[model samples]
Target chain A: MRPDFGLLLINLGINNTVYVKTDPREIALLEGLAKDDRQAIETIYKQHYNMVQTLIINNNGSADDARDVFQEAMIVLYEKARSGTFELNCLLKTYIYSVCRRLWLKRLQQQQKFVSDIENVSETVPVEDELEAHGQRNTEFQMMEKAMQHIGEPCRSLLEAFYIQKRNMLDIAGHFGYTNADNAKNQKYKCLMRLKKLFFAAYKNNTP
Target chain B: MEEMQLLDAVERYLNNEMPADEKAFFEQLRKTNPEVDQLVVEHSMFLQQMDRFSDWKQYKATLHDVHSELLETGSIQEKAPRATVVQLWKKYQRVVAVAASIAGITALTISAIAYYFAPKPASEIQLLSRELANIKRTQTITDKKINALTGQASTRFIPPADPKSGGTGFLIDGKGYLVTSAHIVANADSVYIQNTKGDYFKVSTLYVNKQTDIAVLKIVDNRYQPIKNLPYALQKNLADLGEDVFTMGFPRTSTEIVYNKGYLSAKTGYNGDTTTYQLAISANPGNSGGPIFNHSGEVIGILSGKQTTAEGVVFSSRTRNIFTALHEIRKDSTNEDRIKLLLPSSIKGLDRIQQIKKIEDCMFMVIRY
Candidate 1:
């Protein structure tokens, strides 16, 4: 049986009266999404992906375009859910439709495919702040990725084994052929320093 | 060393692993020293960034897997643009006919105009792999005709079955895990991999990422014996430009392994695709999914395709993609097998001939049906 989110819903209700009318099912799904649960993602995709795809296809976009925009909007929703501060004041459908619309509009303007305003019967909420936060996080994630790529071999693998994989130093030592946990820890420290320098360098360049 | 110690202490304190007294002492030090306080704040932010970065990657990978799985299961469908184009063509059929007749009268000029306005980029590169299935189909047709005439069954070592596509694959893990080009086996009904010794083993697809053109397969045949270790290490770093690189593949009708030597010509593939490397190597239809080995015998890339417009210009997906693919595969809870990648380069300092001898044992012909 799925774990009950009744306690969570009650706590959220008492903490914020704004979410009193929000569906507990939506909250549970978002919580699952925050945890990166596969079933939850699949459920969301099955429910909302078609609606978003139809919206994009009707607005002078191909099926591939629909898939891309929908996935990016999903990422935006994921970022919001993972932040743990999102308060659902509207239906999940309306919010997703809003986010996908805003994203598709920006994409259209970029591609010079802007013909006219997209037609939508659904209600939309303001999501500028959410999109901005998502954009900033996306940039930082990319910078970190570039740094990881640049930091060559053993160093890259060592830090990843520790931080990303969450492997203990002793287990990592045996896996990477290091002599002892202290040796692995020392190597990890060096790698971490290099990664930080590269990451901050890219971060500074992007911001400035 | 001193900085390492400080960072370790900060990490312990941040993680709340420090004893109460030690934590209190550290808090007092942070209050007294502005630099220590700054260090704690900076380290905390950096660690948080790392954590979020890891989460973002995992989430993106899961999204990709989910998208592909849904596509396969037909939960979501991709609309083809061809249907609309065909309808438009039908509506303009008369106008097109008139234009075609007029163009035929001025064929030379029309040819020049068409060449000038052609979509150039679309035809620049070609996937140089897989046509053995067609050959097998034709052979089967002939064999059936002979059987109908002779009234006796043809005695062949291998059964007559339809192999959908074929390409080269190599063992990434000695315990029968193989990596090949995704396109070669994307829609295959049943996949089989054959060693150079003509021993065929059944395999199952474990993971596939079409964007990277990488697919991982695990041998499920009981007859196969696992090797102790792999000879070549998959290179994590990009191979240097102009480095001597050689590849072994089955690029011929026969089962014999073929070898070709070339140099790394560019850091990127055709159209500046960063995920792949361009090489000055001669590759043919059956060369896809072959491993491109550097001088030290580290597998740097997997030969994917070649530029059709340029002679001797081939491209191979970077080796690091395999690492990323394996990492994503390991994250799936349903998969119990832990795929460990061999890191040490045992073939280092070996001659070209000896290196090929050892590498050939790990190479297999991917048979898709």
Candidate 2:
């Protein structure tokens, strides 16, 4: 959850919050991401959300644009950290800022808007592999999300319960009202195969 | 049939359920079959996307709570303008009223949908079982048709039902004798065994026990040396459930020797077969004939197929059965001196890594041409 600033949401849009330096505590906090702790990431977002907002808003973007880019950058970091592919070469805040700046630049370029502060973004050289991995992940996530919408129910929920919630076969059986875990197991396989089919088909159509 | 096995293997590999050797084989497949590779990526992404969606909802809920607290405490550094507050309230009220009415309808619709789906959970198992049977029948018919047209090359394409399984095997005695799964070389006219050194030797199947599905082969190449006093021996006793064990195999057709360790998870094989014990290792098809060894390097069982119904459940034929089969093979007077009757393992009590190091040379791959 975002920390409440009371009526001070106005200050969130302001550019004066001093950037935080990476500390030992922050290292521990980033490590929490690898452990799949959401609270750590949310705290990271809470701290850096304002910096991202100021960057985007100052550079010909909207508050919504800042929010989206900031969120995407956080996801990028989250995935990298979780995969153990990231190294703390620089401060965590610096790393996230670079990602947001790069994303903002990409957006500006997509709309054919000239980016004035492109030099500032180029300073950190945001981890290339991380950026690419995150890009691929985002693309996959979006495609899969779209495919999920087209899928029929029960199968959808079954996938969510098993894959998303990481529930066991028996528990899933009980929740989904199957006769037995084995029965649910077979049904789950069919659902997964079908989901893969539908997802791949949609991905193909969408890609080119 | 080969295509089906490939798909199954790909699925398991994508799930990270394959042991090291089998995983290497799957990596090779990804290099060769771009379609399979793409399928893996798509399936993984699909699963990940679902997880991301779940997390997103949780995250948004937390964010909403934070937003409410900020509003309640008015701790925001600067108050939002009075005019902006009024305008926001006006906009919010409209949204809230619309959202309230939609949510009411949505709740009713959800309950109706839930009720419709709740009662009917029938025939899924029966349907899948039948579907599997149908696939088997179709595969057999296709194989028979291909057999009929073997002499003449035709436009029709028929895949082999029993696909090539590059399974594992280990030398039981130091005299070029090896034990592998019967199914690995079953119904095959020509079979070759290879080792980690890339040396391919002719495998003469001396005994094929179909009931227990264990095969004993003698490596016949004169150039191949009978490995000296072996460092490992087959266990005369059964492996207790939850005993620490490890195995090695040429899972990727001898690309690299691979080792995996897990505990014996069950006293009997799938469906409670007494001749085999179920291990918790993620053994794959290519690891079918690998040896399951105790921490002291005693060969306890033969590494076999994984149960498709669950993850991390592997079944291995008992070493005792392999010994029993060897005993039966040695009973003939003419064969008495030809094949060694009793092959006992001499190595024991070594650490895990050292045991693996010594036992790796005894491992072989049963490859079908």
- Each candidate's lDDT (Cα)? 0.87, 0.74
Candidate 1 CAPRI classification by DockQ: acceptable
Cα lDDT tens digits, model 1, B65-135, are 99889989999877654456775798799999999988888998888999999878645443212356667
Model 1 root mean square deviation, Cα atoms: 39.9
TM-score each candidate: 0.47, 0.37
Q: What clash count goes with each model?
A: 0, 11
Q: What is the C-alpha RMSD of each candidate to the true structure, in Å?
A: 39.9, 43.3
Off-target runs (Cα >4 Å) in candidate 1 are A1-20, B81-369
Tens digits of per-residue lDDT, candidate 1, A61-138, equal 888888888888888878878879456788888888989999889889999986688886776777788898888888
Tell me the interface RMSD of model 1, in angstroms.
2.0
Candidate 2 lDDT over B1-369, as tens digits, reads 455456557657867889999899788878898998887786666656667766655554554454345436653222222355665677699888999999999999999999888855577778889999999999999999988888575542322334365688888777888899888888877677777876677778888987777998887777688876678877887777789988887766444888889999989998989988988886666888888888777888887688788989888889888878877887866674355533455557667777778787888878865
> Which pairs, if any, clash in model 1?
none
